[model samples]
Target: MGGSGFLGGELVRRSVMDGRVVAATYLSRPGAAAGADWLPLDVRDRTAVAALIGEFGPDIVVNAAFRQSDWVTTAMGAAHVAVATSENGGRLVHVSSDAVFSGKAVTYTENCVPDPITPYGAAKAAAETAVQAIDPTAVIARTSLIVGDGGSPHEDLVRSLATGGRNGVLFTDDVRCPVHVRDLSAALLELANSDRAGIHHVAGADAVSRYELGCLIARRDGFDPARLPFGRRADTDLPGPVDVRLDCGLTQRHLRTRLRGAREFVK
Candidate 1:
């Protein structure tokens, strides 16, 4: 585990213990947790990352760090980590994004090759390809909008509505299989321990829309029901497939644990 991001943080906390020493690092966490040995280092800096690799001696490495959370930066970061992890004799699990899908269909399986429609999606798709090329044993866990507690955008919207920032919110008509960060973290670790390295769709239980998901979050958190009304979605223009919801059947059957459903994740 390299990043202490929302999902990444949970993964490290669970996976690292007496038998496992988590090499958790962060550039600037503002404040580090008491138990975590959070380091100040950048993954793009090969030497620093390599030094951490040598010190931790981890059996498995999960590249949950996304560079600038965009295309070029993310791809390069993933490529660098894959190289370091493979050369260091550690298994690699790279977190990928569903933006890689063209969003042309309702759902995508592990079978769907990525046809990225956005810069972020392109980076992730490229990163997946590069990681696979270097080490076919590396696992690529492709996930969508990771929703959870701890000040996420989903939660922010509720806050905004509470303070009356806006009367109606504009949600995308786009459909996605949003996974809860915590459950997804568990699923990835299960895949890692199993040594089952390949492409897998790590998504939530339902194929839902942005509007539906927003309403669900609001309802679950007990936000004002009347103020959160159905809003319109922006028509995004791009050059590839769109709205490809992921089908995680392969993940369901392969891993030891059954991933939580969309509703379960929301809760």
Candidate 2:
């Protein structure tokens, strides 16, 4: 529903390219993505969500709307969308995050119980629980850090750190499986058109440390890698790093699409 966001924009572009009629929702930032009808939506409002779904009557409702700083919008909003979509008899493909797990395990499968350590992760985990309870058939695709040709939040943070615009230390211990925006978007659309339901791990094939990711991004973007300082979560006196590595084998087996690694697309 977040047509202006990176992933949402990519999905809209791909949907239009495939000649599908697309209607997207935006909040504060108006979406400039072409070939899609845009509408203002406050997903936090249950009545508004139901009304919007009734107006659109979309065969598949994709809830890509999220705000990191706003839990009401990110967590409860997902529940509202799920319940509304379920009542309307529409398939729901809710985009989720890998942060839903604690970094305790080496790798996570779709069946892994959520044990979030961060506030954002907790919110995501709660959203997943609510969605499943309200709509058991909805496809909850939990993905990791998203990157691609078009700049994303992850790339923006890396660029800021690499160029010394933002003074922050990259954690060598924190690891994540980052997926390309286009690849994930295409896979979401495929799932939207299919009957697959339940949780799916849609992420990159490789997992890399945040420190390594910053260095690779710096080298690829013509920035000084030396400017990015590497630090450990333990040394920083912060909570332990949320090192999540998703097992996307099930996703790969279920879909024909191949999600590539960060190293393959950074250049």
Candidate 3:
């Protein structure tokens, strides 16, 4: 539903490139989605969600709208979208995050139970539970750090760290399987068109530490990787490194689409 955001924007662009009739939804920004039919939607408002869904009567709905600061928009709003999509008999592909899992596990399968350690993780877990309860046929695609050609928030943050725009150390111990934006968007579109229901891990093919990812980006983008210092979770009082390495073998086998790793896209 968030056509303005990174992954959402890519979906819109790719849909248009594929010659699909697209109606994108935005929360506060209108011009964020350049092409396609733009619709102002506040998912937190249940009535607004229903009205939009009824009028549009979309065949497939992808819930990409999320906010970390606002629980109402992130969790409850997802629930609203799921319920509305279910009521309309529309196929739903909800975007979830790897944050739903605790870092205790080295690798997480699709069947891994969610045990979030952070508030954002907890909210995402709640959203997944709510979506499944409301619509059993909904596809919950849990992804890791999203990176691509166009600037994403995660990529921007890494750039800031490399350029000294942001004063934060990258974690060397933290591990994640970052999926390219195009690959992820394509996978979501495929799942949206299919009848596949239940949780699925749609992430990168390779796992790497956050420090390695940041350094890769810095070197590729002509920034000094040495400017970015590394932070060890074991040495600090802060919450330790989280290893959200998802096993995307099921996704690789299910769909013909190939999920490229961060190494391929960093450059």
Candidate 4:
């Protein structure tokens, strides 16, 4: 689902390239990617979700639709998808987030239980719980910040800051293990086709702060890295994790796709 989104669009593109029959879901408008059936779906509607998945009868379903601030869409919508997928007898791969963890653990493994400090994190945690309960065989892939060539929100922010289009400071204390969208999409497909069940951590190899990440993007995009203003997350009243990193060691050992770090990919 969410074929119009950045990560979702990549998934649809790759799946179509592989000659798979694809049916991608969007909210408002269809994505630019061709060769896939673009269907309008509001995951918040349980009946609509069930009807669509039932009619499609896909062998594998990947739920990537979410709104960070909407509990109904992020948490309850996931549950709806899980239920529908389970009833349709299809393999499910639900995308989750690292926000489920507080920075108290610093680095988290697949075994780590979610202790979210923010509303978004709590919603993600709730989604994970519901998916696991509904479909024990489902693959719940928890990924970190998803960066792409020049399409991701972070990349856009970097360009805006560097070109004086926006005013903001990249947080030096806010650290995360960001994964490339292509790598993450490929990994999700691999897991979807495999028998891998339960939670899996799919993230980049390197953990860096947001400021460091912005600098890397600036350098790659032909901008002066020094011009990117930086600040400490600790100095702000922001309610989120400071240094949450996902340890993808165990999951990496099982995948053929090499998850590239931000430094290498941006450069």
lDDT per residue as tens, model 4, 48-113: 999999999999999999999899999999999999999999999999999999999899999999
- What's the lDDT of the predicted structure labeled candidate 3? 0.88
* Ranking 2 against 4 by lDDT, winner: 4
lDDT by residue (1-267, candidate 3, tens digit) is: 999888999999988888888889998885455568999999999999999998889888899999987888889999999989989988899999998888888799999999987778888889999999999999999999998863877678778988788888878888999999999999999988786899999999879888999888888878898998789776678653377799999877888789998888888
Q: Relative to the true structure, how large is the alpha-carbon lDDT of every model?
A: 0.74, 0.88, 0.88, 0.96
- After superposition, candidate 4 runs with Cα above 4 Å error: none
- Candidate scoring better on lDDT of 1 and 3: 3
lDDT of 2 by residue, 1-267 (tens): 888889998998898999988989999866778999988999999899999998888888889998876889889999999988998899999999988888888699999999887787888888999999999899999999898864887788888887778888888888999899998998998898888999999999889988888888889889888999889876766653357899999988988789898888777
- Mark the regions of model 2 whose C-alpha exceeds 4 Å error after superposition: 239-241
Best by TM-score, which number? 4
Model 1: per-residue Cα lDDT over 69-150, one tens digit each: 5554588778877888888899888999887888766578898878776677788888999999989998899987788863
lDDT of 2 at 132: 92
Q: All candidates: CA RMSD in angstroms?
A: 2.6, 1.4, 1.4, 0.6
Pairs with steric clashes in candidate 4: none
> Which candidate, 1 or 2, has the higher TM-score?
2
After superposing candidate 1, which stretches have Cα over 4 Å from the reference? 16-19, 30-34, 67-69, 166-168, 234-242
Native-to-model Cα distance after best TM-score fit, residue 234 in candidate 1, in Å: 4.3
